[model samples]
Target: MSSLPAPTRRSLLGGAGALGVAGALGGAVAAPAHAGPWTPARFKGAKLLAAPDRHLVGRFSYGLTPALAAQVRRRGGARRWFEWQLAPGRIPDPAVGSLRTWWSGLDRGAQELWSRQTSEIEYGWAVMEDYQRYVLLRRTRGQHQVLEVMTEFWENHLHVPVNGDAQFTHRVPYGDLVRRHALGTYEDLLRETITHPAMLVYLNQAVSTKRRPNENLARELLELHTVGRGRFTEDDVKSSARILTGWSVDLWRTWRASYQPEQHWTGPVRVMGFHDANAAADGRELTHRYLRYLARHPATAQRIARKLACKFVRDDPPQSLVDHLAGVYLAHDTAIKPVLRALVAHRAFRASAGLKVKDPGEDAVSTYRALRVAIARPPEGERGEQYAANAILWQTAALGTTPFEWPRADGQPVDSASWSSPSRMIASFELHYTMSGGWWPTAGTGYRRPGQWLPRRRIRFDVLVDHLCQQLLGRRSTATLLKACSEAVGVGRREVITREHDLVRWSMPRLLTTLLDSPYHLRK
Candidate 1:
């Protein structure tokens, strides 16, 4: 039986903020899990494919790169490139590593953060900004494109919003938890996330006791994380909570998952057909076994596959594609790589291109990559790096999604239509416009030597547009877009080159803003 918890903190129900809103509106309950695996007959039709490279880069990475495109070309095709991206361990992430040096707090243990100062709101936000910037830089610049994509997908799949002012400290470990198991077996990721202190408190499992079991974590594990809405019942939720009663974080061990037998409900419990047999003092082992069983459930396979297909394929992913991906996930016992490989190789994936629109975060990062915008602070060890990072975080927050900040656990939406509204579209254009003029408008496109980054020759308007089109979009400009861009800057078809820095400084931002707002840049 599905059940929603009464008015509490968060629900994470059906859609983004669905559960939270459900809680406020006459009480909350667990989501309605899928009755069965999705079928081809369910949706009637599937979206067809559009541009190949554009689709690949858009779906696989937050941003597109000439280097990333070239890598795919070298690998012979999108399928092989995807396979290669799956083995991110073999790929070095120097850009992310370099950013880490700037973010020293990321290395601090949970205990250190807890003891240092948990109540300082500004300080907590600063630490949170560092974590957010790490995620942003990695997505926008990291080499493991597919790995990053999966990281984002799994982060949302197992959403754990910040619990309080001090929980910002735990986000570091939480992000690590997601990244470590991002491409691994499903069981490992589930185990790691549930046991982590951040999730424990976020879902209220940390405080659950035998006297009063908190169903928050247990219910979501079934409804949101594993079997999904209809596969389990209310009794299973109660049982799952009993199984997890003693599973709390060890503040003594840097806030790691720990067990206190005194708090455990050692009596028998059952989640679906799996049972604990009421074996006293066996809660931990049963919890592990029960979770592993859930990991292997057929419903779980389909649930995870549908989510992956939703992310990588179309908004309403084809049920046929979901079934195919589910088979791969189940056959491999939920090892992530195999499921993704099947997804990349699927005909549905290749066909359903350009139909998906970009989310706010995706749009911002993609714009940065297309513009080759540098995310650096002032040179000579300027004191404003932290402020700069905070500024960028605020920028992304305005777009409606940033890392670790979704107030509810459902996370940002996956469908393109959610972000396609005219208000949001205009907000995106304003952001791109500001960045086009450099992060600070006064900085005037903010390159130490902007000319060096540009084409060496003093090119004419038409040639400049062509060069930028190739640079930013990886293709020649469409007739309509080229005409609009030229007209935006009052340039005639037969314009001539000129060596005028003043002209470039004055006009380039406007022209580049036009390019960024073009459908070519906006779509993928």
Candidate 2:
């Protein structure tokens, strides 16, 4: 097959920002409230994939990729590959290193971000953009796919956004907090997030004091963070507030959190079955004890398990599965790996194929991986990134969601229902069409710049269609799918069709876009 030409920087910058998808949505756009982590979607012509090859790639990673599928097969199957992913320390993430080229100050502290000496600027927009791109790259191309997937889930679970410079300064380290315990125990994860300056500031814990105990952090801790619901009362909220007092940020010292006994309320605090005395000044130790207790609570286990089940298994997970997963969570003392291992091993996970509809971010990542796009990193100041990033960001926004961009603490939904609207689906079709046509790739997809829709081997149109289906979907092209591709370029007979250059060239975008737009590719 011939290689496509690289888009010039001029063409890339010239409205590549829209990805050629501006105002291309169909019907009415759905409101932000329509989607969530558990929304159900009804996909048209969704593939019923019985093969574990596709299932594993879909479950553990963003979507099915040939490279990922081969890795799974190389590891002896899905389970072994999943086991390999569980220990990310064993995974060599060379792709993660390129992050510095695009996003600087990932290693800097709040002081650097506050100062002019570093790329960590006082403007929160820069940090937000860099971090968002960082998230996009890691999610799209990181070798530690499971870890990235889990980290995304946990980051959303412990949702914190950088809307302003103060938020940017503190929330810069939030991703680290999520990564540090991405596969560790939930107790550790909870304690780390709650103690972090970003969460403290975001949840108003930094301002909580003996005189004015803000219950925001305490409320979310019991209501959303830990126990989840009906298990904690207003008294618990008020008491937890007093316990969380003095967890203040040291602005003079890079916004590091420091416990102050002076601000802590002195008294015996009882939250549910746990009891601890402030000892007038030992609020830090007392708080830690309370947190551990909360983390170990059965309710917390059930809450986390239900969420996991919903994420990995199904939209509305069965009570049996939720209970079973909850036991797995508690049996291992809230250690994440065991619960996740048992989850994959569970019958529900194995049975779920094409069950999940991809979110906007997931769809975008899947498209990039499907096309085998080489992640671009030009000079520090470049137009390609601006145009490409704007396009991606807008597409994600149009889907009504993006990583860490959820304004609320609740985070973006994981269900398909929230993202199955006509408008979003049409936007996806337009985006994929643009990509398949090689319009947005300023250089091209993959290490071999100037991407091609046609395979290297000279094959017939029918064979080409079949090859594309396998390449993109890991399955053979159905008659319906083949007809959709062939007819797009006015090919009459399937058998009589030959290697017609112009027809194939014309059919490339239509065929590729149709395949990607199919419900099969939309679900994972």
Candidate 3:
């Protein structure tokens, strides 16, 4: 195997410190302070705090949904609701037949047969559409919120470029790797990802040989996957790459053991301060030992804890809480369920408010979930198929979070600063308006009847506002918003009213546009 260049202190510092002032600020703010243990009495019957509610919904659920908000109120508070979400298997599965059918319809073999040649780009787009559809169904279906959230988290953690040739064909395996193991043991998930064909191709490990080792996969395996920054050296990365030599894809070929002894690195390698001392050891054994070491490292525990806390608790989670979760992770040998349990039970998790920003995926899925929109079945004709594809692709693009197509391996940032860009904000407003208006393109087979498309009777302004507030905002609208909506609906001409039969048809789009673009929506 090729030897690694020794890590320089300067290079380490440059890479580690690139996190900049934001990292320092996050670290400082995340320090624990002396707060008495939480007492339920303090929060009982208190006015619902907007900030905490927003954070709670953003993290535990898809985003804030009016039905979820009301359910929280009925159940007493966020703590109980969070506890339920952490143990997602306890909830029954909602009907997801439509979602499953949508996925099944995208089989590459069928598509290739029809198109006469396989376009990797087209296949990637189809898989991404299925992913978006599934996410939307998960939110709206209501029973699998926790599973969906965990799936998203794990997918980001083990990110593979979707555009690669092998990854394009094996997208199903990549997705299945995440979904099946999302809530299982963290170690298992990490190990599975290491040999997965998608990852091998995406990180250029497929061609990593003893003579000319590629360090891309090794670098990310530590920097992004296990220890994150400062915990491993460049020398360690190089050594790790050497140890991982001989791992290659069985693309389009039957999966026999792909490890070629002749191709393997039978040379000494040092990694993370330990030498593989047995230079001529079996390749499989060497790979297993290396992965086990990474999975069990203290740095791995810390990194995983911080990420979980950030996703479920706050933007900058309390160090004490993270430490506690890390301890749990270690004690359980990186079992995900126990760590999740500890996170849900922590006091900091319940108290932090307005700390997370809804990624576009979260925002779009949560809205559909709140509205109880079912994934529509494909119609009988070519027009129907085109419409279904177009609608899903357009919505995904509009939200700026088309699945499997993130610009970076880090996945889309979950901070408001990234998502609230001017163009993004405009897109959010437009999507909300379109959804609220029930304005599906009429040139398709999935078209709704007039009654389904828009309500027949005139909806009272006050009642309409209340329903929307309860459904979309999860709280009653402010008096100013209510007054404006009432004025807008009351002044429209009969011709206009007839043209837009539903109150939602006429007013909801404008109202939702305002709400989604509001500072309140941006905060959590």
Candidate 4:
């Protein structure tokens, strides 16, 4: 079958940039001087998003949903809300509780998961696809948004893609492990992630033996996971490889993971300041010590601080904020929560609101959240359309990135420009329009009806526009937005809109699309 036609590059750019609206919206749009008393009196003090709250919620969560915005207010403010989110265990998460049961493949043991693929009962790619859907649903609906955001961050940082041929069976388990340590200390997280079977197999450490130690895992441990580059030498890498020789998995067979002491290379090893004597056949203790040293290294602290700042603060984070966070990381013994608290409390993070562009996964999930789309569980067999849990995975892929499917070990890029390309923006525009219209993935999902958007039976078009802006974008409406919305529906700003109006009957999608297509919705 022929595919849907894509927009021409010129048309896409023109569609967004032609309206001095999005370009002007990209910068702060001064709230309409005379537009006021718009919010319903009941929700004014409770749900109104102040500038600071919007920035905090937008920066941390996938996107600010109405429920989340209210929660931030009920909990006091952004700082208090963030503090509440820090301890994820205290947060009740019923959304993903049954995900493993829905996608039964996720609960299978490594042996069974591997056997199913080898016996052709199920494809490895299909199993991984379920994992992606599971993640998308969780991001869209989970109450513990901070945990989800940080899990994605560390999963990318110490990535073992579900597509890895040797690591597919262990991939889901690796993701679970990452989530467990996502809010914990970096030392514990690094140790657990590096020693996991998925990491070993993905980096070729499963095959590394006393006779021939592979340097792939070791080099990446320094360059990507821990100290980053320039702090360690070739000799450090070789020694690091030798130190991590015993952790192995039964590859291409049972998929069982075990520590084989005999396969370990026995020799004195030194990497940076970490040193161990050549004595024991079991090097697990030595490996743990080395990873702890690396995790606590000043360079590792700097690298982790800068990466966190860049992802949450801005594309190019300030050095002062990075330095402050690095000090917090060390002072707290690499605890993640303290570093996060320090980062958010810093002036740089507060000032960097609405500056970072959402990556593909963020964009898709946030759109779902903003639209208040309800995704139902898929049936036991095939999934698509009504099976929105599965269909949403492809939605993200069409946006140009699929979760954990980043080809290289470096994982997906987090910077703004990486996702700000014309093609990506056009793809996002198509997604906004399609979802706004409730066109695809119709089954097992519920899009808010046009009539439900009415605050009351009769309201002014501009007031309604302001309500959408506040509800969806976490801010009040700007004059440009009012004009765009009016133009989008071919109505006057002062015109009264009712359920019987044409704008509510058939042109609602166009109006919603105008807001979703704005830079206010695109940038966090």
Give all candidates' CA lDDT scores. 0.67, 0.71, 0.60, 0.83
> Which 10 consecutive residues of model 3 have the lowest summed lDDT?
37-46
Candidate 2, residues 371-452, lDDT tens digits: the string is 7767566445555454454346655666667678878887777666677676776677777877777676544234222225
Candidate 3 per-residue lDDT over residues 1-524, each given as its tens digit: 11324323222221112222232112222222232221001101223436555556557666666556666777567767666666666766656544566555344542342242253334455554555655555555655566777887888778875544445555555776787788888888898888776787778787788888899898999898898888888889888888888887654443222665566777678877567764664587788778888887889999899988877676777899989999999999888888987886788976755455566776666555544444555554455555533465567567676655675666655444566455665565566556555564334323223234223254434444544554455555444334334333432211222335554444445544444433334334
Worst 10 residues of 1 by lDDT: 37-46
Q: What is the lDDT of residue 378 in candidate 1?
A: 27
User: TM-scores of the models, in the given order?
Assistant: 0.84, 0.86, 0.76, 0.93
| Candidate 1, 439-524: lDDT as tens digits | 44232123323344346556555566666666666655444444445445545434554545443656566567666665555554
Candidate achieving the largest lDDT: 4
lDDT of 4 at 108: 86
The full ranking of all candidates by TM-score, starting with the best, is 4, 2, 1, 3
Clashes of each: 12, 10, 1, 1
Look at candidate 2 and tell me the lDDT of residue 430. 71
> Clashing residue pairs in candidate 4, if any?
386-443
Model 4, position 91, has a per-residue lDDT of: 90
Give per-residue lDDT, candidate 2, residue 413: 77
List ranges where model 1 is wrong by over 4 Å.
1-50, 118-122, 250-257, 377-388, 439-460, 501-505
Off by over 4 Å in 2: 1-50, 116-122, 251-254, 382-384, 387-391, 441-451, 493-500
